[model samples]
Structures are given as C-alpha cells and as structure tokens.
Target: MDYGIVSLRSNGMFAFLPLGQRVISKLVALIDEEMRSISAQKLSLPLLTSGHLWKITGRWDTTGQELIKVQDRHNKDYVLSPTHEESVTNLVSEVYPLSHRQLPLRLYQTTSKFRDEMKPRFGLLRCKEFLMKDLYTFDDSEEAAVVTYNEICNAYDRVFQRIGVPYLKVAGDCGNIGGNFSHEYHYQAAIGEDTLLLCNACGISTNSQLVANPDDVSCTKCGNQLTKVTGIEVGHTFLLGTKYSESLDAHYQNEKGKPELLQMGCYGLGVSRIMAAVVEVLSQDEYITWPWILAPFKVCLITPKKGSKEEGAKPWVDHLAEYISCMQGFQNDVIVDDRDKLTIGKRVTEAKKTGYPLIIVVGKRACETVPLFEVIDSRSNKVQVLSHKLLLNYLKEVSIEQ
Candidate 1:
C-alpha cells in the first residue's frame, strides 16, 4: 500500500506494517484508558481455548463455521477464540469461591481474535484475524449487571465522542453472542454493510437486522417514519445476564451466605475494524484525515532539496522539534522527513496521505528578511506563512508544534 499501514497476506489475512501497528497502539491505549475509568481490570487470554469450554455452554455446535476449531497432535479439540465468554466464566467459577464483594467486577483485554470468514474483504474491516478489545462484567444480580452494562456503554460513548465521529448507538440483535438486550455503535458510511434505520422525528437509530419488517417498522421511542442508512459497526455491548455464569456455575456468595450465579455482560470494540472504518468515513478524495489523537505524528517537518540553499531552514525545524520533544514531553508527536531526493511538492503530497495534522515546510522563505516557514493545516487545508517565532505561537495555539 502507498502508506505502508497494512498489506493483504494469503486470502483473508493481513499484516499490519509499522505504521499500522502505531495506529492500532494508539487506539488500544485510548480504549484502555476508557476501560480503566470504568474500574475495569485488564488481563490477557490465551489465543487457543479448549473446545470443552464451548461445549459447556452448548456453543460448540451452535456457533457455525465462523468459529475456528482445530485439533492438536493428541487429537483433542480446541478453538481459536472468537470470544472469551466461556473461558472467562470457567476462569472465575473454577476458583474455590467468589465473594459478594467481588461482584460487579469488570475485566477486559485487547488481543487478537480469529474467525473463519467465508468471504473476507475491505482490508482489516472483515478479516479472518483482527485485533479487538473485549470487556466482561460480573455482578451478583441482573439489576446490577444491567447497571454495569449502561455504565460501560456510557464509557463507549465517551470514546466515540473523543474520536470525533458522529456514531449511532442503535438497538441491535444479540445474534450468536445471545443476550436479551444489546446495542451496536456504528459510523454511517456509504461502504457500510449493515443497514441502520434512523428515526425521522426523534433521531434514534436501530439495526434493521433486529426489526421484523423494514416497511412496517417505525421508531419505538416516537411514532415517526424511519429512513434507512448504511453503517459500519465499530463497537457492541450486550447485557448477558447469567447466560455464561449460570451455564458455567460461576457463582458468588449472597448476603444470606448462599451461592448465587454471577450476572454477566460483554462489550466489544473492533480495534482494527475501527481504524479502517474511521478512515472509511473521515478520509477525503485528496487527503486522509485521521482523528488528531490517532494521527501517527502531530507535525511533519519537510525540508527543501539536500543541496539547495533553502535546506538551511532544516536546522531551525529540527531544533524546534528537538526542543518540543525534550522540554514539552512530545517525543513521538513530531517527525522530520529527510527524504531530500524528492521535491518538496511530492513530499508534501505524501505527508498529506500519511494524515499528519500539521506540516511545516522549510523552504527558501527561511532566507528572507523575516525568515518565515510555511505551515499547512491538513484539517483545514489552509496555508500560513509565518516567521519562526510566530510559527511557534501558531503551533502552541494548535497544540502541535510547541
């Protein structure tokens, strides 16, 4: 790919190059921060889970071909986990005894998940192996579990808001995850595969898959006509009350000192899928626009030709970047592109594609009486010619250069 973010492997798999990995790491960090705010504890799960665990919940056969099942040399059955409900339940229940105080527990992890997609396409959006952030909640009762579900869902809302995209929190089907109540977070885009019905009056959205009839359905919140929109699902939440816990006997002590099944819920955010979907929705015909926090670098310094007199401005840009890194704690937020063989025009074009929020061009202007450099604002596509001191002030205003 031009940007070197990801590449297609054999058929349904993809390899995320360094740039892609950096983007995923930023997204993961954001998700981790949001999860921790909800008092969720982080943990890692094995990529391979025992088939016996799925059998315990009767999902071993119910989960169609999408579930990737394999065998070891001993011929025992195992699964490349598509989800961790069964494994997490067994992990919690197998303990001698869980306590009431431990109820309302939240656990989460960001890891690779596997599924045997019949037809994978759209790059990382629908790949066989992808990164995901999944959170599981345990509570002493269904009421408490529902409360945890809403709390986590609110946290998810905060994340999407920070991502700076208008997303729909639509009522959705439980499907294979199987819970009575569920919601999906999606970004409406032309290439989206899922159909969403947006209410005309109250501006509510619901997944069409959950509605029995499209033509007959109306907004349940308000009696208004519904219009259809396509969307890419980026996140999902399920109020799984005692489904996994009761099936696996994951119990915690009650106030009466008796064992009671732990109510459960699960939340999922498609890490790679979101990265792709954000690009799908936000990128323009001429440029890629990443969310400011998710951009690989806040500023890219582009110097003139290697031997040209304009190249003198390179030191000024580098000195400023070094100062910002060493004094202001912005170590990896700025980069200097020293590919001087390429013309400044070509370099600027490539930097736009890389989605740098701000670009500093050190050209012949540095030799002028005022000695100014050009700053291009990708978000606004505006060019400002300012001297070194004003450039620093502008960067400080945008919170990028300074």
Candidate 2:
C-alpha cells in the first residue's frame, strides 16, 4: 500500500527501490542463463583488493583519478575494485597454476562494481555503484585466446538477442586494458551516448573511436556516402594475450617443465547499463515492450469488475487466479493481478509499463459463458480470443516465435 521513491545515494551510498530490485533480478537471471549455456562457470570475488595487486599491474598509477582507494586498519592500502581481471587472475594462479590441459578457463561473475565517477547520471545507466557481468578466459596460446574470445563474443551476441534488443558488433579500442583486438556490441538508439559508423556496402560497422570513415570507398549498394550514426555500447570482448599473465607473473609449467605465461582474454557486459539501454531502445509512446525471453513477467492476468468494491470480485476471479497459478506451476511464468481496488484499465496500463509479454483480461461474460479470454500482444498489436484450455499452449507457441 506504500509506494515511495528510492534513492540510490542518500549522501553517496547504494540504495534501491522495489522496482529497481525487480529489474536487477530479471537482468541477472537473463545473464546467468546465457553464461550457463556457454559453460562459463560463475564465481564470486571480493569487492576490495589490496592496492599491491594494482601496483603490480601498474594500474595503480595509470588508472587515473577514478580509483577508490582506502587503507586498512594496519595502514595497508586497498582499492574498491573497478574490475576483477587482476583478482581473478591472482585467484586462478593460486588454484589452477595454468596448464595446456586447462587451456580455456571461462569464469564469470555478476557483482556490484565501484568507480569514483566524476559525474554519474542517467539513473542506473551511469552510477557510482553499478552491477556488471565480467568474464575472463585463459588460454595456452594466442590462437586459442582468439578462438575463445570469438566463442564468448557469440555468446554475447546471443545474450543481447535473447534480451530482445537489436545490436551490432563494432570494432573497438582497447583502452586501459591493453589488447590486440576488441569489439563492442552497441544498441542503436536515438538517445545513445556513443557514436557508430556503418558501411552499408561492405557490411562494416565500428564505433567512431576505432573506425575510420573511408573516403576512398563509397557504398557499393547505392554509391552513396556511408552514413555515420551513434549507438550505446552494451558489451565488449578483448583478446588479451599474456598481458595480465605477464603483469601478474601468472605462469604455468609446460609439459617440458618450462614455465610460460598464460594467454588471456576478458569480456564485459554492463548488465545494469543494458537494462537501461533496453528501456531506451524498446519503449514507445504507449508503453515499453520487451522481448518475451527477457520480459520480467511472461504473462499478466487481470480480472475485470465483479462484486462490490469492498467485498472483492466474483468467484471466477479466484478460479482464474487458481488456473494461472497452476499454469505457472507447470513451468510457465505468470503474474496474477488480484488487487481488487485497481480498475481493469489501470491494471492493463501498469502491465504494459512493466513490459509483460502477454496480457490476459478475464471478465464475467468470457469466464462464465465461454471460459475464453481476450489476449493482447503488445509487440505485434494483435488481439485474439482463446479458450482457457489453450492459453498455455498459445503462449508457448508465441514465445518460441519471439
């Protein structure tokens, strides 16, 4: 009964509202599913690390003024990790001691990251406290690193696709983390903060930072100048060969008993940022529509007017609620809006705002006489009348199509 705005920072600390929690939970589950599909094992890392680790990697000096540094009770300097490559590498060195047999180790984690942003804005898009899904891969050779990097890139592609936002892969610059090659996954949106260039003829697309607009070549399709536009970067992967390994002395004993530095690659998906990107890219004038696979709730069931306002609705409301409950019990995702006070129109509007895939409206006429309900598909603007018995099957078929 109480709805209040939640502030992320009272004076400069992390806080969240119920809606924020729901969005984060959905994104984490979506990301974890993608990671598991690729056999990337999930691991948790400490939020704080000794400054010595950054010093060894030389990032302590080069990471600029953004690093959040603190001192322990013993006066030992520590850093709130903006990233976990060094930490993950150190942990692996202590445990796995890389061998060619364990060449491609894919590990990932979803956790809160800290950066002393000079100006954090745009709600969760740019925040001092943010959530990220960072993954690291270890390989025995540069060739192996490239292959694994591509595999992870494909996994990222699938992740965005399943999330229902159309994105393009663009060549990217390897900024602080030195690497040979990198690519960024960007979602095209009018309000995006990054720029992208595309060649319609050659099918080449890249972020403006890493792409050169070729004056020598024109669009092969129409012989027109290729257009350059901006997009929001949602994810990126880099092929890092022995950079972190050499920096951290992460060496492994070869078969001949010789020690060699392990090759490495790092992939990052801004989980929370992608959630905002989804909202920006997928929202329309009426409401937001998420891809069925990534929608927080697969279906929302709403009951129409019944009995008196205070006494609650008719018996069919309970029957329909029970039916949806049973359907969800059979592995379907459904949210029942059983609130008796809210009107049917208001509930439908709220359902659209929440980006549920399917909306089912149940009324006395449809419930008692035909046992059929009206279904609204927000994505395609299609409406259908289907019997209660066929609802689950219909949802399954439409979900697969999505």
Candidate 3:
C-alpha cells in the first residue's frame, strides 16, 4: 500500500487510490454481471434516512447505539443509514404496490454505509464507513422465496470462486437481522476475527457463534471430527421470510386477491471488506499478489537498465506497452515502467511491490537478438520467455484460463 493503492485516513477509514479503485471496479463489474443474470435491478438508496422510517420498523432503538443519528435545524431526527431495508421496502411499496405479478422482485444497491463502531480495527474489516452491496428479494410465497435464495447463493459462490479465494459457505446466525435462517461466506485467514469449525470428511462448516459445542463437535453427515479455523466473513445471506415486510407494512395482493406480507430475503456482500480480506488471505509475507480478474493491471512491462545494452530496445518496449494497452481486456492497464537511469533490479523490485499478476522484462539478450520478453508470474515466481509476435496470443490464453 506504500505505492498509494490505499491511503489510510484514520483508524477505520481509508481512501482508494487509482489502482485500488480499478480493482474495486473490476470486482463490481463481475458482481453486477452475476446479479443482472439473476434478474436483480440495481438502484441507489439515500445515505441519510428519516427517523420516522426507522421508528416504523422499530429499528430506531433496536439497531443499537452504533447507528448514527442526527437532528436537523427544526430538531427533526435523521439517521446515517447503516442498512437500507426500511427505505427500500417503503420505496418499492410506493412504486409497485400490491401486485401479484410483481411479487418476486429483486433490488440491490452498491453504496457506502456507516456505523459508529466503538472500536474499529483491521482496516476495512471493522470500519465506521465502508462500501457494501446489499440485495433485497421479495417473493409472494415461501417456495418462491427459497428459489430466489438459492439463486443468490449460487451467484455468491460464483463471485468468490472467480475472485480466486478459498471461501467456505457455513451455517450462520441471524442475530439482530431478524431472519429465520442465514448463511455466511468466510475467507479463511489466521488473522481473522471469527472462528469457524469445519469437517474435512463431509465438508460441513459452521460459525462458532452458531454452534453449541464448537470445540468437540462432529460432522453430522460423515461423523468426522471438526477443526477450528479463523475466517473473515465476506458475505452473508438471510432468509428473512416476512420479518422486514410485515414490520414495515410492505404487503402485496396474492392470486386470491387478498393482501399478504411479502416473503423477504436480504443478501449482503462487504465490497470494501472483500478488498481487505483479499489482502489478508492472499498476501505472502508482505507482498500482495491479486488474482487476474481482481488485479489492477494484469501485466507490467519494464524497460532494461538505462546504461546497459538492452537499453537499445527501450523504444520497442514502449511501443509494445502502448500496443498491449489497446487490447480488449487490458486497455489502459499495462503499466510500462519507463523511469530513466533506474537499475533493472530496482525497477523490478518496485514493480513487484505493486503486485501485478505478470511482469515482462525486456533485457539485453532479447533486445540484441530474437526480441523475446522474459515474463515473470508474480504469484508463482515462475519465469518464461516469449517472443513479441506471441505476446498477444499468450495473453489471450491466460485471460481465457483465468
């Protein structure tokens, strides 16, 4: 982060540098694609909400002291919304009121949320403000609600897998969210705050908070002994049933033309938390190597030593970098280290610290003869040489594989 990927502001908040923002954009794109495939509509909700909405659902007091409330010039109450359930539910009721045809509606928003954490730590893990992707689902019946829930679970699984993190879907507690059931997606890490128990034989996992005897529990499916591991929660899904709808008076007309409470579910992914969790789990020692899809740049091309023979090919290196930047997937993402008078070792070290997936070094031999590029895989520390003519093909294949 010394390269300005993320700049620390205080105990719980930070600013995303250009590189950091690019990674977040890529992650959001992937998630947006998945959510749109499942017919979820994206919308933005206000960051500040009226206290009346919170009071309607009794969340004004039940939401705890972490909630930030403010008074206006007229002494009217407002809240820096920690969640958007009341606002969205009320909005949807006004937009599409009491229609059986619009029963199973899915709406989501990707925005910053706030909570006055008493003790915020671990950067984005526990923050007073963070980006969150919260999705709300409305269904007419329990069966339809389950279908929507499973669809969201599958989408969340794809998201984690594509991000190349080893995450587990474990049984989770509903807690104050007021849901019938919940599931959490956890990324295993030694520095994580949450403890989870896993069964190797049956692949069963559960959060320690939800288990009665987490230390001595056996897998109910395979009778295997459980192992405890620390994990960071990156995503959570709740089968809320009618918890929010009934409390907020969000009712719809059914096939019988009778008013019934919508079966509700909420899914949340900690967008900024995922960024920090990726660093926590994937960082080797102090170096950070991100997956291709989540990396700010997939390739970094470096020129040779300024005084060396390889410096003859500096123009060609610059040309190749520009050409690569115009390609479909890597547009404007090829970082060409063209700093003059820098040694090859120093340039490579600086580039390595920024965590590009692949690095290509144009050295003396390649510049003098066959014009090959020495490619280095940052994550694996593997090296390979490829000719200029084959660089695009190699990138295409790598992109397809990732």
- The clash count for each model shown is 0, 0, 0
Question: Where does the lowest 10-residue lDDT sum fall in candidate 3?
Answer: 173-182
Candidate 1, superposed: residue stretches over 4 Å from native: 175-180, 326-331, 400-402
Error of 1 at 243 (Å): 1.3
Q: If scored against the real structure, what TM-score would every candidate get?
A: 0.95, 0.87, 0.93
lDDT of each: 0.86, 0.74, 0.86
Clashing pairs in 2: none
TM value for model 2: 0.87
lDDT digits (tens) for residues 51-95 of candidate 1: 999998999999999999999999999999999999898999986
- Residue 348 local lDDT, model 1: 94
Per-residue lDDT of model 3, residues 55-125, tens digit only: 98898998899999999999999999888888988887675456889768999989999999999988888
**Cα RMSDs, all models:** 2.1, 3.7, 2.1
lDDT rank order: 1, 3, 2
Query: How big is the positional error of residue 59 in model 1, measured in Å on the Cα after superposition?
Result: 1.2
